[model samples]
Target: MSVRRWWWVAALGLAVTGCRTTGSAARDGQGTPPKQELQFDPVTVTADLELDKLNDEELFAGGTSAFAANDFKQAARYFGRLADFHPDSRHRRAALYNAGLSHQRLKEWEEAEHRFSELADPEKGQGDALDAAFRVAESRYHLERYDEAVKLLGTIAAREDLPVNRRLEAQVQQGVCQLEAGRGEEAEKTLRKSLATYEALADKDEVDDYFPAQAHFFVGEIYRLHYEGVKLDPAKGSDKLAEDLNYKAELLLSAQGHYLRSIRVGNGYWATAAGAQIGALYENLYEHMVNSPAPAELNAEEAQVYRQELRKKIRVLITKSINIYERTLETAERIGSQSAFVDRTRASLEKMKALLLADAEGEPAPDPAAADGEPHS
Candidate 1:
């Protein structure tokens, strides 16, 4: 699906409640146990009345109205008051959830965290409490407290009472937090676990492949970062240089594998991104191989052979990169995707072609058949 359509679906899904069932469930957790409801935007307040006279429900309605109108500050005020003043009211839990959501929309990270923390209380409602905790963890993530976010998500994911989907989400989110915290290795492990779980869920028809698609995309990102970190030395001796190049090749191929899996999962947006990244991976490889200096100790014949091999390698890399970009562009067009990623990929394809042509037009290497009686492949 196009991203715009996906976003629209998300917005509509958030505007309604009672579409899913949630009930009191106890688990071996310190606080409220997780529920199976798909609570996205919580319940919105829709009361449009004087604050002094408004009852709890009315106050909640007012908050909902404010939120729907994009007046997040007013929405937060109404929901916060309903949650605090009418603590025992039936609407209190929803009010608190909405308030936290409103505060998040306003970028009031601290207030959002506080509101979500309140609903996470086991003394209140355990049904949606896990959802609240999830929101709290997300708020911490927005605040750049990645360690705290990871910790909270981990706690949520550990609860047996939580639905499998929620647990998987928490696991993925925890990985994201770890990645943001510069814990790449930990993130990779976490994400890979989530990926496996997602595949299991997909196989059971418990969840869509979209979740695994997301996991694969993030895994690709982790490896892409690893590939980018591989440094090549132009001045190093041939042996060391070859070792580094081999290591770089391994990283690049690993990244390629992850990206290919992401694309194969068939999530339009992520697939598009992964396809584009595949192009970029090969482009980087080509540049690295091309710019790396040959060892100075080699005789003229050896140097010619080395240059010929390098050119052959560059041709393969650039051609593959261009092909991937073309595939990405076609996929985007096929999906009616309207993302900047598609535009960038198209531009990259043109640039890659130009680079390939430039390499092809460069000074010719000696024919191996003429020089050494060996046929060129």
Candidate 2:
């Protein structure tokens, strides 16, 4: 559920950059077109001609220029004009695609979906229709229309004509869509199948493994979140608590297996994410045990004994978590990577070190009310 809430933050946690083709007139959509001025329709067009005065080709060129300059708002408007107002223009398909991509860059999901859906329409689509269809799924995912995204992704994944990587991406996105839809079990099965497909691919090494890496990391999250749901009842005493903890541990190790799989691929971002989550698993366990309700059967003197002894046993969790955070941070540095996960690992590492130091110094637990920013009573 935690993953579902923010999984769309980076296109399944990928700060991925894709290719952009500006137009025939411009240099690869980089800076301003140095040589190509807008050749307006046989009139004395001024240097700063308005959008209304520009011809369709000129609009296309302007959109490309705007897109290259990271002015996606202008790019969307110009490209939308080329696609909508100039139906007869030769650059119509390119214009629509550019418009959709521009909208996506701006996080305008509905507008992006509309543009892509038009190009992906059976009657309207051309050679790039498959790509447009994929973008439509992405737009739908961003819009939180997980069911629609899953359906569209299924169709994309089933296509034999597309590249293996494209199909794999579709399948992976489909699984994630299912997860976002609150279908965890189905999502895990779909993700496992996707991983199997990736493993079976002969050209797997030649292509990007981002999707598969995500598959591993998300499966780990699935288990981790499930583990978070396991509750303890102190009334059940130590033996029953041990059983509950065992189940929780099994879920964590299951998650840990997937996290290990994610790191094994060496895709820098996903690996960092998995590593951070792995540390959090132990940290969470420590917190959970320490914060559980005290056993009702214990006398006041016995309760103090229980708390101290419990802290002594669970202290290893902090140590283990600290080790993982340190290692993960080192791995992120070695890979020359930066992400929220790396920041989290660094912070968690510091926090755990503080906890370990506090315990070592025999500092009393801070009062609960004073945990707020107010001075202790």
Candidate 3:
């Protein structure tokens, strides 16, 4: 069978034996509703293929045991059977939850998405629905359905019922999705909001120290990615886009500052990663600035001023990039030697510096006497 078809068949099998098999019966209406009670049947499907003596708790325990043993496929099977056969059992919802988690562990993305999506349906199982929603969004993200993931995460972000950390995580994921979808402006905005929220929560001692830095790192990545994309684009006409590009560049600068601050406050992989990203952004901006054409409207004085400012920015960025490269190289050397990737990056940085230096020398000066003799406007 085709991959998609096989995926669907597996998903169908899981659904038939999982949450989708639950009965649609409502309790009878009375003056007062009947006291809710969990129901279970004792019939175990054993290795001999005989349903002999299994209780709901036993079945659930078996599934949990399988999960703990890293037999996610077996765990899913057991959990699916329980969910399918014991619809009214208290373990039914939990069974479905376990099934979803197991599928996720198995990397059965479509199957996991189906189960999580079902659990997240408001009209269906209300047990940990918010968690399910988040997982569904995560699954979609992994599947590269970035727009769908963003939409789902956006909803989660807007909900007040979610915990601060969960809400912040959703917001960050939404920003990630937006970035993947090429909505850089939206991603930057969302990531900024997430970072601010994380910071506020951290200040109140509501969250761990790591979350805030993670938020900042993601925000930094958004700006860095945005700058890279704009710098790569060949078209140059709109003042608005140029302004946006400049704004993104400034954001990267600010992000680099934040990354350094994070390192000062707390040492972690995030700070190191952020430092590398900042270096890459600087290289990208340096290359763009070096290649940028001179504006037509500038007089000699205006041109000189513009060139001076540009040179200052480029020089600062180039120096920063070189510093970061040295640090990365040291880390790589300690880690057992540089990879081809790092070698290529180092070469690129060197080329970028050469270009920047060439650009910094400015245009060749016409002979002052000849120009003065001939030029009177």
Candidate 4:
């Protein structure tokens, strides 16, 4: 079944109470979580209204109106007031959630963190409260506080009482945070488990697949980074270089396995991401193999022949990369994918073709092959 992709890409908009609703039960976590992106011009506040003059109802009504209109700026104001001054109001909880969500939409991480923290109270840590915690963790993630995000998301994921989807969201995010924090071993375990759980779900179409796609991609990223880090040096002697090449190939294949799985997950964004990565694997392999220092014992004549022959061999790598890039570009276009990975894929395809052309035209370029390190997103 066709599924929604990212959280922001998830079409489930916030309700008047700021909770997401779905056809499934709330316990499924399908109806839990907030969203992002600003499609409408935000409503700006021209003047500060006296809080005493307007009742809690008025504040909530205005907030809901503004929120529905995607005027998150005003929504934050109204909801923030409803949460702060009218603490006794029944709308207080939703107010806090919406206020944080509004601030989050506006990219006010501190404000969003503050508001969500109020609703994330452990005493009331159920339903909306859990959602609030999730948002707080996301705010931390945006803030690059990966450790804090990981801790909070771990807590959220451990709650067996909440909806599985919400827990899944937390779990997936925790793995991503782990990845960002440079916890490769921990990130791999967390992300692999996330993929397993995602696959075990009975109703896969009912929730966003972004997390699973992320799991696959980040797991691939872990090994891809490893591949990039693993260096080969002919200066270390042919035997040691042979061992290094074998180890590097293992890392490369490991990375490739996960990238292929990411593509198989079939999310357009991640597929392009994986596709770009697959191309990168070959491109980088070319870079690794070609850039190694020539053995010191070689005569100038032998070194020239070595360079020419090695160039001939690694041209296949460039060809493989170009093919992968071309195919990825086709997929990106067909899926209407708009991601940095797609942009990178386009850029890489051009570079690979140019490098190949340079080889054909015998034009001077970087030694052997060039591989630009792919971004982590």
Q: Per-residue lDDT of 1-377 in model 3, one digit per residue for the tens?
A: 21111111121131122122334454576544544545555443323122125666777777777666777666666676676667788877677666776677777778788877767842222336876787788788789899999988888778786568767777877887888888878887887887777656535456554556666776666545545555433244446546856676676676666665544434345545555665676677776776776565667897788777767666666666766766655555554543554665577568756764675577443333432221011
lDDT of 4 at 71: 77
Clash pairs, candidate 3, are 44-54
Q: Any idea what lDDT model 3 has? A: 0.63
- At residue 195, candidate 4 shows an lDDT of 78
Judged by whole-model lDDT over C-alpha atoms, candidate 4 comes out at 0.75
Return the clash pairs for model 4, or none.
none
lDDT of model 4, residue 359? 85
- State, as a TM-score between 0 and 1, how close model 1 is to the true structure: 0.71
Off by over 4 Å in 4: 1-53, 61-71, 121-124, 200-207, 363-377
What local distance difference test score does each model get? 0.74, 0.77, 0.63, 0.75
Candidate 1 backbone clash number: 7
**Clashing residue pairs in candidate 2, if any?**
none
> By summed lDDT, which 10 consecutive residues of candidate 1 come out lowest?
3-12
How would you encode candidate 1's per-residue C-alpha lDDT over 185-253 as one tens digit per residue? 999999999887776654545656566777788888898898888888857777887888888888877
lDDT of 4 by residue, 309-365 (tens): 778767877877887798888998998889898888888889889888978788444
Best by TM-score: 2
- For candidate 2, what is the lDDT? 0.77
**Candidate 1 displacement at residue 24 in angstroms:** 66
Of candidates 3 and 1, the better by lDDT: 1
Best by lDDT: 2
Estimate, for each residue in 235-263, the C-alpha lDDT of model 2 and write its tens digit.
89877887998899899888888998998
